[model samples]
Target: MERLVNQDASERNAVEGKFGEGKRKYGLDLIRARLQETSETVIALQFLIMNLGRKLRVLFFKFLQNTILSFDN
Candidate 1:
C-alpha cells in the first residue's frame, strides 16, 4: 500500500513537472483559445515542439562527440 501511494505521487509529479515546464519554457500558460479543439491543438503542437527540441539536442551531442573523436585520430 505504501509503495503504491509513492508510485502514484511520483507519476503525478512527473506530469505536473511537464506542465510547469511547458508553461514556463513553451508559452503554454499564455494560451487563450476560445474553442476546445483549438486549445487542444495548440497544446499538442507545443509538446511536439518540445519533443523535437529534445531530439535535436541528442543529435547535436552525438555530432559533437564524433567531431571531437575524429580530431583525436
Candidate 2:
C-alpha cells in the first residue's frame, strides 16, 4: 500500500513495517463492517413497515365502509 501510494503521490510518503495480528486493527475493521450492515438492515425494515402501515390503513377503510352499508339495510 505504501509503495503504491508513493508512486502516485508527488511527495515522499512514509511506509510502515509489517503489522502483527492483534485485537486492535482487526477488531476495528470488523466493528465498522458490522455497523454498515446493521444500518442497511434498519433501512430495509423501515421500508417494509411503512408499506405495511399503508396496507393496513386501506383495509381499515374498506371494513368501515362495509359496516356502514350493512347497517343501512
Candidate 3:
C-alpha cells in the first residue's frame, strides 16, 4: 500500500541519517581495522558512544527544563 511505502521510507531515512551522523561526528569514517571482528567491534563502539551522547543530551535538557521551572515557581 502507499501508506506502507511511506512508512518504510520514513524509517529508512531516520536510519540513514543516524549512520551519516556517526560517520561525520564519530571516527566511523576513519576505521582502519583490517580484521572483520575488529571492524565490527569498532563499529559497535562508535554506535554505543553515539547512543550514550544522545542519552546525555536528553538528560541534560530535562535537567535544564526542571531548573527553569523551579525558578518560575
Candidate 4:
C-alpha cells in the first residue's frame, strides 16, 4: 500500500542518515582492518562511541537546565 511505502522510505532515510554521519564524523569511511573479526570490532566500537556521544549530549542538556534554574532561584 502507499502508506507502507511511505513508512519504509522514512525508515530508510533515518538509517542512511546515521550511516552518513558515521562516515563523515566517526572515520567509518577509513576502516581498513583486513580480518572479518577486526573489521566487525572496529565498526562496533564506532557505533558504540556514537551512542555514548548521544547519551552525553542528553545528560549535558539536563545539567545545563538545572544550572540555569538554580541561578534563577
- Summed backbone clashes in each candidate are 0, 0, 0, 0
lDDT of 2 by residue, 1-73 (tens): 9987768663433112111221233332233334868856664554566557779999999999999999999
Q: TM-score rank, highest first? A: 1, 4, 3, 2
lDDT accuracy of residue 49 in candidate 1: 98
Instruction: In candidate 1, list every pair of residues with a backbone clash.
Output: none
> lDDT per residue, candidate 3, 5-73, as tens digits?
999999999999998999999968999999999999999999999999999999999999999999999
Model 4, TM vs. native: 0.92
lDDT of 1 at 41: 99
Off by over 4 Å in 4: none
Off by over 4 Å in 1: none
Q: Candidate 2: RMSD over Cα atoms?
A: 18.3
Give the Cα error of residue 58 in candidate 2, in Å: 0.3
Instruction: State in Å the error of residue 9, model 2.
Output: 40
Query: Residue 50 error for model 4, in Å?
Result: 0.5
Which candidate do you rate higher for lDDT, 1 or 3? 1
Per-residue alpha-carbon lDDT of candidate 4 for residues 37-58, written as tens digits (9 for 90 to 100): 9999999999999999999999
Choose 1 or 2, whichever is better by TM-score: 1
CA displacement after TM-score superposition, residue 60 of candidate 2 (Å): 0.4
Indicate the residue-level lDDT of 22 in model 4: 97
